[model samples]
Target: MTPQPGSYPGLTRRTLLVSAVAAAGTAFAGNGSATAAPALALRSGSNTLNADFAWARKRALDWVQTGKPGTIPSYWAGLTNRPAFYSRDVAHQMLGAHLLGLDAENISMLKVFATSATERRRWYPLWAFQFDGGIYRTDYKSDDNFVREVPAVFELTEKGVRQYLWTGNRAYVDDAALWKYYTNSVTYFIGAHDDNRNGVADEDGTGKIFQGVASYNENGEGLLEAGDGIASQYQALLAYSIAQQARGDEAGAQASARKAANLRAHFEKNWWSASANRYIRGFTKAGARTNFGKENSWFLPMKGLTAPGPRTDAYLDFVHKSVSDLPPFNIEAYTYLPETFFRWGRVDQAWKWFRYVADSRAAYPEVSYTTIGNIAEGLLGIEPNAPASALSTVPQLPSAVPWLELDHVPLGAHDLAVRHDGNKTSALTHHAGPRPLAWTAQFAGRYESVLVNGQRQPAKVSVVEGRTLSSVTITVAPGAKATAAV
Candidate 1:
């Protein structure tokens, strides 16, 4: 289905893509030469403190230049000359690229995985992508690997659709080849890997889920099954359901959604560990629980698989307590922890973790890239729903942070600059693109009134996952600014 014109606000595909690609070319001209893009002018400070946003921005841009040309161009997992693309790493990297408005780089990475599906098998490569002329190699061995590398393909499909959502690129959504690849990949994943037929894919019974090297924590041992794999499957199924619905396949979409819901129910039943007050990491083949204290258990709340309440509260508490024990610069755990904390209303903890990582300036792409994302999408809460021509801003600015400003945030066709002062006052200046923009400002506490552009607008109050959230939506023309006060 072709989206109607003006369906997604802000930038056009040609404008965004051309400019992004041009910037990339200028930054990385010549054969595989790397240069960092200039840091974005994102500033945050208070009376007693200030943050160096430029450092994080420069590091993130530097990481993207590590992209190497191959069957499809993708950012390397690290600076090492391994010349391989790990699916999970690529997935998170692409997400960071999208948030940074690096449209060309993000699309290139997505295309690599999108086109790298095993020929005729309809599944993504196991974990790594080995480059050869135009051919890509999957790191699958019958004896050493038993669990199907489901997350890679799942993430590719999921993130592919998300790219369309963020860019409003109809041509990509309507591509017949990509649709076939994505649908077939999802079908194969369900048919081949979901051995239990319980909607969640099971390990090959060889060992822990990570035993097959299918997770971000590849070196860990034990029966580390179910936690990340199961949660990721649930997410993949939901994403597929959305993709199916978008493509006009009602039956397919419904089936996927039902399966996803079933998977979530199964996980909640089996994975919750009452004794530990958190989800068990995974189970051994002998039915014994393992890694009860591992951070993967926290992924449940991060993925929104857990319902909000006392149980969810306990889960977040578990994570909060565990943070002190976490090794410094643990990118895998940090990726979603900050966002999860902010969503759960632990704003100070979230800020603390974010600050810790920002201070480290870890050279890992996931570390630097996702940290930037946490600040923009998590702390600032600038969520762009390009499909709807509306974006949501739910700043969880910490109490100590008196002011924060993010400039030139690309939202589909528009560039948005947001400044928040005091605890509840925010000014959004929209540098209009080709279309009008609609915004929803969501505040954390109950408010007596909500003002948009100095006028009181009707505010909607709702409880989400046990937290009170208040929101107001306003439509603005090109070159207009809107101030929201709660």
Candidate 2:
């Protein structure tokens, strides 16, 4: 998991004490019962599921592209400020994300790493090495050979291997070298860290969660301290837990399983708001944790990998609160917070001192964003415009562009048919409900034009998604009570 250069603050003595005590207590928290294996759901319907299918597609893609096998050329170019190419980080990210969902694309993506020589030849040892353990918050220059010296293994990469096996690619099972790295990474994710110069890399005795990794956010709010995040950890746990079962390392696997099981407890106790039902960004030694970030605190529940209970309701409420009544950018939740922090200061200065607040706000304005992985990278996946639920049925690959066929919809917003390729324009005449008298399309290059309620909305609305609203928007009429439902 990559920590942020987007700085926040350090913990005070009181907060640090709480973290210490909390970490200690959590060791005994979760139910010891072994977690059951994960399975992906059968392909359901088209893009018309009750729960916005497009949104789910975007996140699932993120989970895959970032987790395991797929090589996302874009994230490479975007983050490192270099030309895009397949890399290890994106693969592991993609792999871990799809383990539970059993998404075909995700599975297919992971299989690429496990079964294909294509991946091995392109991003091998670095990919494998990065998987087991390595920190990559920032990019490295090729001239800087020192990048090789400090590279460490990550437990997440190991956790990912367990899921990779589920793909049933026999070729993967035969590769002894790749198989060994997968197992070793799992061992490290569950065991203690070796930061303290202990002979063996097992120094997790502080009773802290997963052997702590000392880190700093240069542009940070407080001083450097501990690491935190549930998204990556949970993904890793799911992967490792299964790997242990497959490798017959029952003890090691169980221990990792317990750790994974306890994550919700750790998250809830330290980062959760019993009052709000919302999970926050990871804690510092300090008591102040923010409600938003690049990833959702509710990933455990949102994916339904595990049950959520009342916490689920509370989390949804929290999500409702954090998201704008009228969204300006269709950003996946992870990227929303920085924009808010820089702009709005929440209750009680609640988020004033947290990491990346000042910089994120200052850096992005007059401009917002869209950080998609890649159309082809399996893990750390990508969304094909407003894509259908399953890509298999669609003849063409999803694109960033959208094509709308509104004339046939009769007056239904959900029924508007769209395509990724070619220019499609059709007029829609609303039966009832207020139309947006004045409006705007949010993105730039992604779209060019869209016609609203026939009359071809005046040139005032900025062109973005070519024909449709960028990222499936919910439009409202100016100074009107009824919102334009999409």
Candidate 3:
């Protein structure tokens, strides 16, 4: 008889690989000192006062667990009661973990997972692991019997690039295991699962999740390929392209880029449903399109796969309505919404969902970590290219926040402070770093010039998500300050 997929009846949003069964000897807190306080801080003053932001920040930082001597760096990103970190949760929580100065943990967790996706396992990494680098047996009875989903693989691949951008960690692009994993995720891994030969990974002719489900929405019906999975694949391919370029493999980079473009083009052309007025959720094993709203439907735009236009706008409006009318049972899943709204320039919606998630669940580790990340990456709009010694700020300050400041934001070698006074004026201070950073100050709408350090500079204009933006790049030396205003 065939083995059944491990059950997770208690979890509304189960892991890509997880088991409901409890594993003995794994029932302990993380293997680390819980005393270390995160150096990262957030502040709000004047009209921009919102205690919710402060509350979430503290709660997020408070969850940090400093690495111990004998174990790899670790944190709690999975079930609050479990002594494990999950790939799905960790991939989602990574940016916040990095901001909290948990770089070692991020690197260790990512590398361990990368190293685990060997040929023997068909390129699927173990879903979760104990803090001490041991596979969490609850989620893994054996390679063939473990639960596995499609989105996590590509999400991990993309997140590796995200971490590299923030930390400028050469290990992301240079590490042998990580580089191999990234390549395999986009190539051999996808190849192994593509039953239709459509250039996208689907189920391996088996509908059973233990064999590999094609979606993050574990409960979805009969899915052979999912929007979330394909969207993640697009991102992973693009990330692999960037990794290739970073490694000086220009030809490989071009090839990966082409693959990403083709995949996106194929998705756009085929995935949209004329009758539904939205993209279908996934395809069934019977080769039928499933029209539904869930991770499968929303992840398309969330992954930056959808082009900015009326279609995207309509879909986002639908998403906001869907979540607002009926919030998800799994609060952890809500963490993805703010980033979704922020990506499309819907500031008010983004903040609403951010605050909502913050207020809803405090125990789930991903909630706290994502709250921290959404504020920095979403509201403050901090984008770092540490490899180039550069940073960009596009403040998405809602009317509710008139002024906000974040201090000790780790950007690779630099610990910088950023403040947003509404959406018009912004400031950056290079608190600590080895070299000056090229800071790009971006403001919505077109302007001939912007005031930088009280001096006028020409603005470079561009359009994104159907909104005009004017930006100026200024160099901020260590122990110095620079301010930009429209």
Candidate 4:
């Protein structure tokens, strides 16, 4: 008998691979086969203010002339050679504005966010919107309303406006600088398309063709990016405010609409993924294109202006299918395994690899920064940013557990089979003296562990869903040293 796909209802490593590859294709056109993709998923306790995701978005936008700016990470940690924070600023500002739609007050909270720079005067002073020349039409000093960082000034206008919601500090909602910088922000798509700053023009604003060098890294390696990251970020928020204002900010809104056109054009000309039947990251002149992982969920559909249309529809398809069932709340950045494309004839083998991973994470648990924050939170923009920070302090899962501490109901995707002797378990609870969670192991057979806080106790492990070390038959391993994290 053929194994029914959704019946087992567990995440397997191979399943993850299958989903990721398939997602890349359907990223544009929905997979015709609904049987393979589950229409809905268990809405787990998740947040959008993902530390890792936030950091990634921040990397694109957070910039400070003094090098002390706080909202985005000062410098990225993992990459040996830092790329000059690239398109992250646009991503952050747009993402932040998207958050604002959910809560008006999130704007003012940004003032406290940029702790690195105490110069509120230089940034968006909270009182500006009410008193600025436009919008509320206030009479504050609008000449010196410049903020630092190209991306921040260009896209963070919504952030400043939000930040200024209560402060009445007129400087925070500075829009003059924003109006001036919007074009340069998207036009600066370097590398693949042009010798200048931007490339071809979209149907909005002035017929300004975007031009930017294909310079991805400091090392001068050209990359496949039609300014997708930057354009998507800019378009998401820009279109939103434009569409919202309608006849209000006519010129500004029109410019934003034009930028959206440009984004659409670029995607069609340079970023559509043929193999996956959807949009992928942009491509190189060499016909090579990058895969869309976690970021793609936002990057692709954001051009939709947050209204119901193809972009929104595309995003909904992804939320309902591939990512909702995968690990890390997205497909892995890129597969290390072979023949990873989903629609290929060898899909079964590729899926086998993918399912293997999903199963493993389901049984064990997650430890990485990204998986816990962004993916688990159902943050693919389905609900905006209402509960963005719920998992800011999410606890780690246990690597080794005699019994699964499933209460209420299992909130994670069914991917892995967790089998163990529950009777051997005595007590399981979070250790809070120095660490957050530490479980006492009365008896241990085999288990997976994730260290939540920095502490070692009698025996307790912390990990996210779909993870576990192969059943360890540990009659007695060395007592966990205090140095071990729970």
Candidate 5:
């Protein structure tokens, strides 16, 4: 079983006290600038479910703050020791922040990092930043001295695409600095770091993090390329492709897509180990593969780079069997598990880890925010493309949650509600928006047809990430509701 926050005997109360003081001073008592309290709510038939959801939801909402008058919109995404946000943490917590109606904060913070990468720093963004937009000194002494990791660069680029998908924000494509960042992250950054010329970014292979490291696993050293780094690069290429398509750059989109395709193909051909029947985690400077597990093993599937089949299933099984052993003590690392399982359509395993992290009661800011993100993106499976005014959902509710409803979810121009009644039925309502919403209500498994508001519609069957989905698209006008059943 995963350990709870209380397991660390000396720190829980003190951490909570500090977090409360921080929240009260900035987020709750801003110069009348903080956004209104998040109206989002999660409810279920079970009392335990309600209680758990409320605990995480409230804690996450408390972290929202209008920082120190001059800072960009901010939320707690790092340790409580300082008023700063870490790149890895912020990128991971983005969905939860967006769900809380912090789109401006997301835009501000992401842009800051997006613009901070420079040629002098080899195109790596600083690892963490103070709320006031200064580089966090503790992590930076000079341009060459900061906590830089390979996965963070690509993760931020990929997450920027996530923001565009959720909000349909044109600035993601139109903004000069952000557009440059997206292009640089995949092209220039990789060019700067690929020592072996393998078309993937690599750290210097000294294994020292301050100089450069390839993976989020800081302690794993001497790695030229880590699984998480390469996997994230692949996704970043895809994200850039999506952003280019949104910008009407067909040639640019196809070029990025081809790069992404080649990267996936390369990973499929090279990373798998037939004897071990699992993906090797990383490579050393000497051209040797290492299966260090943890981030190296799980990040491949989590980033959607794995080809779905027996090999992918076996790796997920390996992850499930060894999850509790994932290290560095803090529960924040385990937060990645829920999304990893969801990527492969393993709902039971997804819920298991979701509950594990949600129930851990960890005080680290990433935990609470990620708990909410998992509810929407993992268990509920929401995919939004606001530019197109479209939304899609796949229900992954476990048996424990007979019915689940999330209300006041912010998506682009609208506030919406989504409900799942087990795996058989799902519903969405457009609460507030100028135009009607194109809702694609999706469910697991194959079906001959589906019922939309009890009217039969031809069910479209398709494979996505190796899972079969039966879906029907409908227009949900403002203040109207639509339901679909398989």
Candidate 6:
């Protein structure tokens, strides 16, 4: 049964107020309902660069609201000229929305894309859509515009499934209409475009690295193969696998998983340059490696395809070295590098780049929204795994900032408020859902014990990419206040 538009309701103010609280300690329980807590509020002042943070937060909230209906709910790429839902721009925008916990807005936009079928066939959407649900342009034409048919439809479908993962709302996931669109799009991408039958979709025999009309660099000119396109396909395969698993299709999930693995292997074998110590841009038609440090090299790590080590470190270092050569807020690399560095525990470098985008106030939704996502998801590391009933906090607090706090973070059926000060941490969960929730807190430094609701729990130490992280996990009842101290 497909859920109709507006089927899912937004979170109420009462729910937000009931979930916000300032506390310390951990309390694990099997059965508990949400309890009344302080209203949700973000902390202000010197530690957080309150003025800039406040502006970014408000901008994200306001920008999401500006989304108007098109074939699917769509956001304008920019305020000045482009007034359509572009395939790549919308994907980045929706990802930012998800990071900010704007589930409803994200879902609305997803529905628009999910249901937009091509005119020639009721399957995939065209490259772009006007505000009135009309096709603005497509890559269907041969010659210069041929790249439009490069199978970027999978990117939108992947994001749609990601929205379902974040909200765990059946309205988006189980909607028959959306699944039909998603399955058909994936099928079309595989059957018509994947000429090699090796699980990767290529551009029409162009011998370019990526055959899509759009490149992550935002340069829609020429027929150069792009690393970004290949990485996007890899992500699409993984996302499809997740969708399959969610529907209890074990064989389908396994098949997609195998395909993703094969694609990764293929990408590494062909694209990696051992001498350069990082993946190059892409290969030319004559099997020549374009050995330049293009921004897309960062995409591999951003997609979780790279393990943490010297190679990953070298990649980050390359990005750092390349920054001076790039324009101010080089939209392509800037959008992703900060989050990548933060996730890999390079807080100093992450903060440096993050400050650049925050200061720029770039108007492109793709740039600004991604900057906002970096602050929330990158520095704060507030990952909401709703389907698993868990919220993971891995704060990358830099040396300059003494503390940081985020309030009213939407998790499935709950609003989570988290505050971290140096090595000590505090959190209050206002669970609106019927069941209890589990929480995990990760710290970069070494910690022997973590106090949960004032009771000490043993901390587990794990090394990720050469950096040691101490993590503690505990279960909290709905409406319970818990805190951890290292």
The candidate maximizing lDDT is 5
User: Over the stretch 1-486, how does candidate 6's per-residue lDDT look in tens digits?
Assistant: 111101001211111111211100121111111123223345733544565566665665565434443234444654436566666666666656654555555555566666666434324465665665565654345223322534357667666765554555645545776777667666675565555575455544343222443244544333244566666666676666666666656688667667666776776677777776677555444553444435456665665555456766777787677775666655545666676677676888888877776667766566667765665666666655455566667766677667767676655556666777754565656545545766777777788987888898899876554567677877877777678777
TM-score per candidate, chains pooled? 0.82, 0.38, 0.89, 0.32, 0.91, 0.80
lDDT for model 2, on a 0 to 1 scale?
0.28
Which residue window of length 10 is worst by lDDT in model 2? 385-394
Better model by TM-score, 2 or 6?
A: 6
Worst 10 residues of 6 by lDDT: 2-11
Top-scoring candidate (TM-score): 5
- Model 6 has an lDDT value of 0.57
Per-residue lDDT of candidate 4, residues 381-451 (tens digit) = 01111001000111121222222221111101111111112323222222111112111221212334422
How much is the lDDT of residue 265 in candidate 5? 80
User: Which candidate, 1 or 5, has the higher lDDT?
Assistant: 5
Tens-digit per-residue lDDT, 1-486, candidate 5 = 111111011122123223222322222111111135338888776676687678877888787765558777888789878778889999998888888777778878888898889999999998898888888898888998888999999999988877776776767666899999999999999999997788989987888878989988877567888999998998788778777776667687668777877888888888887776778788886664645457877898888777767878888888787775655455877889899888677988998888888778787888888888888877787876665566788888888899899998877667789999998989998887757887888888899799999999999887666677788889999999999998
Assess each prediction's global lDDT (C-alpha) against the native: 0.59, 0.28, 0.76, 0.27, 0.78, 0.57
Please write out the lDDT profile of model 2 over residues 247-320, one tens digit for every residue: 44557655665655565345446555555445554344455454542233333333222223465445544544
Candidate 6 segments whose C-alpha is farther than 4 A from its true place? 1-41, 44-48, 64-74, 98-102, 117-124, 137-152, 184-187, 195-198, 204-211, 218-225, 329-333, 423-426, 445-448, 463-467
The list of candidate 3 runs beyond 4 A from truth reads: 1-38, 46-50, 65-70, 204-208, 286-290
Candidate 3 scores a C-alpha RMSD against the true structure in Å of 9.9
Ranking, lDDT, top scorer first:
5, 3, 1, 6, 2, 4
Candidate 5 weakest ten by summed lDDT: 1-10
Model 2 CA lDDT for position 335: 38
Over all chains combined, what TM-score does candidate 4 have? Answer: 0.32
Cα RMSD of all models vs. native, in order, equals 7.3, 18.6, 9.9, 19.0, 9.9, 8.3
lDDT of 3 by residue, 7-60 (tens): 101111111111111211121112211124237777876332356556666776
